[model samples]
Target: LYGAHLEGADLSGTHLEWANLSGTHLEGADLGGTHLEGADLGGAYLDGEISFAPAILRGAGARDINLEHIQCETFTEAFGDASVTLPDGYAAGEGKLSHWSPEKLDWENFYEAWRKWQAEQHPDLLPPYYTAED
Candidate 1:
């Protein structure tokens, strides 16, 4: 498998060409530069509550996944023709999608900020003494 906790794993880089991975979680795994010719990954969660970000899905099949919520800033040429799937009540391409860039906040900083915001906005879902430092 190319990631953690995959239930049904048949991710042959050649067989799954141009598959869709929107809102899927494939954290802490390795895809070894697979050819994702035309996949879709809109609103996908490559990372978890930790600092680790998922490996790039460059050149994989990505064309119609929602990407408005992703933090990545640099997409591979594979995603050039893909369409970002939007959430309900939102326009198809109106989501916030970005690629990884050095200028963006570091993972630690981003996680901390995300935790803080989540705590403030949803106190019921907040854990006690939630700290992203590990």
Candidate 2:
């Protein structure tokens, strides 16, 4: 699911184990009980009214996730497992954070920034948008 546009998608109970979902946009996505074990969500966009209505993230690698953007009763109910790779705020089992509105997150800017981040991270690699031979 690399670089896929899944904005506001209902991805409940989807089996995405060990999949490479890098640079995917998941803003406002319904992730209720979505199995994300071992999934790589690096640079994926989750900054909006996301439904962790009760999601799963065991052993998943999630980077750059602004936990403040994910809407849930608490951080634990929305995410799980200490092994799951998350940002500094929600990386501990004893940690707990409350939900907040989407007034602070800038989705458009975040998405664009991720693209540039990828370029910087991998200088030799070319994005499909730029390397197409057509």
Candidate 3:
């Protein structure tokens, strides 16, 4: 399925043994308790933007995949007895591996500032709560 959005689909506790799920957009899919034994998830985007923020990969085997750019809080409970092949520079551990803030990046900050400035030019679109008496 090209450019198909499969967000929030509950495929949990299903026996998908040896399934071919290459190049599928599984954004926000509930895969908890799903038996994905010997399944190939190569080049799959877990969070769409290279994020490892505690995906619902509980009881799924994610062996031999490039997970270098994934930034999660922890992967202790997710990857249980699974052979997960991460990228070269990343190691599985507890804590923040990467931090993404809109205020930190120069380009993002400038773009956000410009957007805010553009939005303020229109008075009608502005929320009424901001002009309310304190």
Model 1 Cα lDDT, one tens digit per residue, 9-102? 3343443344445456554333334444334443344432212123344433233334444434334322222244433433322233222111
lDDT winner, 1 or 3:
3
State the TM-score for model 2: 0.54
Can you write out model 2's per-residue Cα lDDT over 15-128, one digit (the tens) per residue? Answer: 876566778888888888887654656667776577865666544444445555554333432223232334445433343522211122244443343334334543233233
Which run of 10 residues does model 3 get worst, by summed lDDT? Answer: 94-103
Best by lDDT: 2
lDDT of each: 0.37, 0.53, 0.40
Candidate 1: residue 92 lDDT (0-100): 22
**Model 2 pairs in collision:** none
In candidate 2, how many Å is residue 7 off?
A: 0.5
Better of 1 and 2 by lDDT: 2
Query: In model 2, what lDDT does residue 131 have?
Result: 34
True lDDT of residue 5, candidate 2: 93
Candidate 1, overall lDDT?
A: 0.37
In candidate 3, which residue pairs clash? 52-71
